[model samples]
Target chain A: LAKTTQPISMDSYEGQEVNITCSHNNIATNDYITWYQQFPSQGPRFIIQGYKTKVTNEVASLFIPADRKSSTLSLPRVSLSDTAVYYCLIGGATNKLIFGTGTLLAVQP
Target chain B: SQTIHQWPATLVQPVGSPLSLECTVEGTSNPNLYWYRQAAGRGLQLLFYSVGIGQISSEVPQNLSASRPQDRQFILSSKKLLLSDSGFYLCAWSLGRVEEKLFFGSGTQLSVL
Candidate 1:
């Protein structure tokens, strides 16, 4: 499994765009970048996923550079409801994941 | 549309007691099921996964075991519970698609004393 590193915590105010980056220097070609949001007591919810370049949805966007060694999760117009733990995961052929401690984003009103 | 159901919502068990947690998925067929544990203020730990009925793969070895009696039913069991077993247990399911997202149950909070 490829290990991922992310910030422990980040802060943002309402109406701001928040970008969280994850570093997976040893990512493989088959690995796809996926992001998930987790609330305090709930299970993780998928935000977005991308193979390369950029992929955007109503909730968030995923940017994977050509090198694929790192990926960024971009959230626009942040709100207090968006405050949660964001996890960057590498999904591949095996469909297995090794989750590291995720980045906690605290959105202020 | 798929939904996952996990029970007891909350449980309290004494150390050395046996444990059982059940999970089921609906509105989908032949989906892959998973069991995960999350400690307070921590990330999730994948405990078990099932690809099909009666097939289970465990990520870590401890006092826990899993059984998939039916295609959509996954169960986590323990012969003797330890204090370390206290945590939030979650059940999830995903499409067989390699890149698909996982849909999770509400969750179960297990307290071992």
Candidate 2:
């Protein structure tokens, strides 16, 4: 499984955009980058996923560079309700899915 | 319209006691089910996974054991609980073939005192 590295925490204001980047230098060719949003006391929810380039969904957008070594999760128009821990995971099946300490985005008023 | 359900939202068990956690999926058949544990301020650890009924694969060898009694039901059990077992346990399901996005259920929070 590929290990991901992300910032410990980030602060964003309401109505502003937030971008959390994850680095997976050893990402496999068949690996897909997936981002999940986890609120305290509940299960994590799938936000977006992408193999390469960029993919957008109703909730968020994922931008993957050509190398695929790193991907960025962009959240547009942040709100207080959006404040939660965001996890970036790589290599879903070939190896067991491992979660790393994610970027804790605190949306401020 | 698939949904996963996990029970015992919160559990407090004493050391050396028995433990059982149940997870069930509706609207999907023969899905891959998994058991994961999340520690405080840490990431999720894959404890067990099952591809089919009576088929189980364990990622970490420890006090916990998982069983898939039916196509859509998975259970986590322990003969004797340990204080170290306190954490958030999550159950998830995905398509059986290969790399599919996993759908998670409401997790169970276990506190062993």
Clashes of each: 0, 0
lDDT (Cα, 0-100) at A94 in candidate 2: 64
Clashes by residue pair, model 1: none
| Candidate 1 whole-model C-alpha lDDT, 0 to 1 | 0.91
Per-candidate DockQ values are 0.72, 0.56
Q: Please give the lDDT score at residue B69 for candidate 2.
A: 88
TM-score of each: 0.97, 0.95
Tens-place lDDT digits, model 2, residues A29-79: 788888999998888888998999999998899999999999999999999
- Angstrom error of the Cα, residue A41, model 1: value is 0.7
Which ten-residue region of model 1 chain A has the weakest summed lDDT?
A: A91-100
Q: What tens-digit string does per-residue lDDT give for candidate 1 at A1-45?
A: 788999999999999999999999988777778899999889999
Off by over 4 Å in 2: A92-95, B97-99
lDDT for each residue of candidate 2 in B15-78, tens digit (9 for 90 to 100): 9999999999999888888899998877788899898899999999999999998899999999
Question: What are the Cα lDDT values of the candidates?
Answer: 0.91, 0.90
Error of 1 at B35 (Å): 0.5
Error of 2 at B33 (Å): 0.9
Docking class of 2: medium
